[model samples]
Target: MILVTGATGHLGAATIHFLLKKMPASQVAALVRDADKAAALTERGVTIRVGHYDDTASLDRAMQGVEKVLLIAGTDEENRVQQHKNVVDAAKKAGVPFIAYTSRTLKDRSTMANLLMEGHFQTEDYIIASGLTYALFRNVLYMDVIPQFVGASVFETGIHLPAGEGKVPFALRDEMGEAMANVLAADSSGSAIYNFTGSEGYSFADVAAVLTDLSGKRVKYTPAEPSVFETQLAGRGVPDVIVQRVIRFLTDIKNGQEDDVYPDLENLLGRKPASLREGLKGLYNLG
Candidate 1:
């Protein structure tokens, strides 16, 4: 059986949906912290196992008889490193055959978004050190995060970001989920690391143009220094660490650190992932 942690989350739910197309419900399990939140999945013939990164025994119990496990990275920013370590240790004890982890793109040298990437890198290191057959899905930024570019708050006035005019490859969460499903279902031959990203790269200015076209409103891109951006976010009640990390990511993008587009996702899924324009069309109505 294949077990998916964080099954109630966006990416996890998408992964489970895609996996259902390839495997039977009986062969799938969802490891969640709250079984109540998983009622919909439970009705669909998925086995729900209560577990959390903080609970090693719960994780071990959930992993019982599980052949493949998808360790969806925990969202807790402060305790994420320890949380991932716990999950990895439990997976080791469970003797699961294949362990698939969702990590960040360019983690080995990511100066941008180190707050987010550091946890992913640490988890990747732990997985490699575990000596288990593993597959790492290094995912890029999600198109969903683009929503932050709008609104009356920060970007409502102007597109304020530290990423100058550089383009960065971004992918939708569903695309990453589909690719992850493929990795989880495939045979564990030689372990592999796949960098999952969209087929095209777009800069903040390009995104601003898309938003303007979609909303029929003029939007301007304003690039700021990383320090200024961090101060602005902090003054607006954004946590200092999160603000710092986001600014760093934008700085990296401005420096052309995350500008490459890779076809690893399409090669894995045998199809092209959704494009930015296509993904943004639906959100236009919401905005």
Candidate 2:
């Protein structure tokens, strides 16, 4: 059987949803914290097992008799590495043969500079050292969050960020979930490391042009300084830690950490992933 951790979250749930199309619900299991949130999965005949990353017993129990597991990344950025390690230890103890982890796409020389990259690299290393057969799905930024980053009425407000001339190859979440599902169900003989990304990269300026054309409004990109961006975020009541992390993220993007385009996603899906305009239209209800 296949068990997916954090099954109630966006990526996990979407992955399970796609997995069902390719396999039986009885062949799938969901390790979720909230039983109520998993009613949809339960009703669809998916086995729901309550588990928490911090609770080793829960993870062990959830992994019982599970041959494969999809370990989703935790949201707690500061302590996520420990949480992921806990899951890895349990998976090893449970004798699971294969583990697939959702990791981030990083430059070859990232050096674990930022909080996000640090946690992911730590988790990847721990999983590799765990002596379990594993596959690493290095995912790029999601296109779904672009609308939120750009703002609701972006044509009037403009695209505000610290990134300048850096292009991000962003893939849609559901498409990635589908690709991951394909990976989970396929034979394990294929490449163990998969870099999932959009077919093309887009900068804020390119996004502004797309929004302008789609919304028929004069959208523009405004690059802000790190201090200015942090000040705006703080004035809007964003938490200090989150504000700092956001600044770091924008800085990384500005430094071209997310600029590379990969053809892996297209190869996985056997077609072109959604373009920037297509993602924006679905996200912002633009025509």
Candidate 3:
């Protein structure tokens, strides 16, 4: 049996859908904090287990009779490290043979986006130290973020960011979901780390050009300094910590940390991942 945490979330739900194609629902469990939120999944034959990172008993209950578990990192940025630690501890206690963790693109070295990499690195360290067989799926920035650019273009006619014309390998969330399912289904022999990314890399300017071509509008890429970008986000009511993290992420792109595109995802999926053009079409509602 395989249990997936954060099953009610975007990537988790997608992973469950992909896993269902390869395995029976009885063999898969959706671990969520709220059972009511998972009614749809339950209707689809998934066994729902109420669980939370803070509650070890709940986690233990969810891990009952499960052979493998996918620990989808929690969204709570403040206590994420501890939350991940809790999950790792539970998995160790449950004696699960294989565990899969979702992480970021580059985590070895400190870049401008240290905030984003810190949690991933710490969680990865915890997983390695737990003496459990684990696979790290280090994911790149999602193409789903294109909607932020599209919304800005429609409202402000310009996209402003701290990343100044740097190219980054961006993968679709659906592709990442499929890759995670494939990794979970495979044997846990090597316990390798996979850097999941799309086939092509693109810069902010490249995204602007795609939007211009698709929308027939003059969309411009306006680059700002990290401080200025953070201030702008703060002015818009975003929390200071989150704004700072966003600025740091953009600076990492400017430094080209996310530019490397690897074939790991395609090799696992046995098909080419979605392209920027194809992802944009769905985001912009363009047929």
Candidate 4:
């Protein structure tokens, strides 16, 4: 059976949805923290196993009889490294032959450092050292967050962010899910890595233009200083850590870390991924 961790999450659930279309649900198992949340998946014939990254024994139990594992990166920035390490060690103990990890885009962070990227790099290193056959999927920022990044009422307030001319090659969450499913179904020999990114890149300014045309309202991209941006985010009730992370995201983009455009995502999906405007419309209901 193929075991996918974080099965209740947006990406994992979407991946399982596509995986079922290509293969039998009986061939798939989900490692989820909440059995209640996995009811839909279980009804579709998936074997739902309760597991948490903090619990190694539970992960071991979830890995039983599973040949392949998709270790979806955890979201807890503070504890993600150890959590990922737990999964890697459990997979090793379970003797799973192949493990696919969702990682971030490969880049040198000697200048602008990213805490998320740092965790991903550490997890990649651990997986490599574990000696399991693996596929490293280095994914870019999801276009699903475009609406949130720009803000909910962007058409009215315009776009405010610290990101300068930084461009991001954003892909749809479901499309990325499809790509991951395809990888899990394919051969897993001689470990490989794939960069799943959009065909085109877009900056905040481009997003503003798209919003203006789509909504028939005047929308503009208003750049803000890092301190001002963080203050505004915190004032809006965003957590201190999250606000700092958002600043780091914008800073990374400004440093040209997320600007690389690649065709691998389309190659994996056998079609072009959705554009930023298209993705935004779907997420924001821009009708």
Task: Evaluate all candidate structures by whole-model CA lDDT and list the values in order.
Answer: 0.82, 0.88, 0.84, 0.88
The residue pairs that clash in candidate 1, if any, are none
Candidate 2 regions with alpha-carbon error over 4 angstroms: 108-113
How much is 37 displaced in model 1, in angstroms?
0.5
Winner on TM-score (1 vs 4): 4
- TM-score per prediction, in order, is 0.92, 0.96, 0.94, 0.96
Output the lDDT of residue 13, model 3.
97
Clashes of 1: 0
Clashing pairs in 2: none
Model 3 TM-score, 2 decimals: 0.94
lDDT of 2 by residue, 7-123 (tens): 999999999999999999999999999999999999999999998999999998999999899999999877889999999888899998889999988775454335567788788
* Candidate 3 Cα outliers beyond 4 Å, as residue runs: 154-156
Candidate 1 — worst ten consecutive residues by lDDT sum? 107-116
Superposition error at 75 for model 4 (Å): 1.4
On the 0 to 100 scale, the lDDT of residue 198 in model 3 is 91
- Which tens-of-lDDT digit does each residue in 183-218 have in candidate 1? 787777868889898898898888878777777777
Tens digit of per-residue lDDT, candidate 3, span 151-237: 544535677788998787788898899989988876678678999999999988778777777777777777778777777778889
- lDDT for model 3: 0.84
Candidate 2 worst ten-residue window by lDDT = 107-116
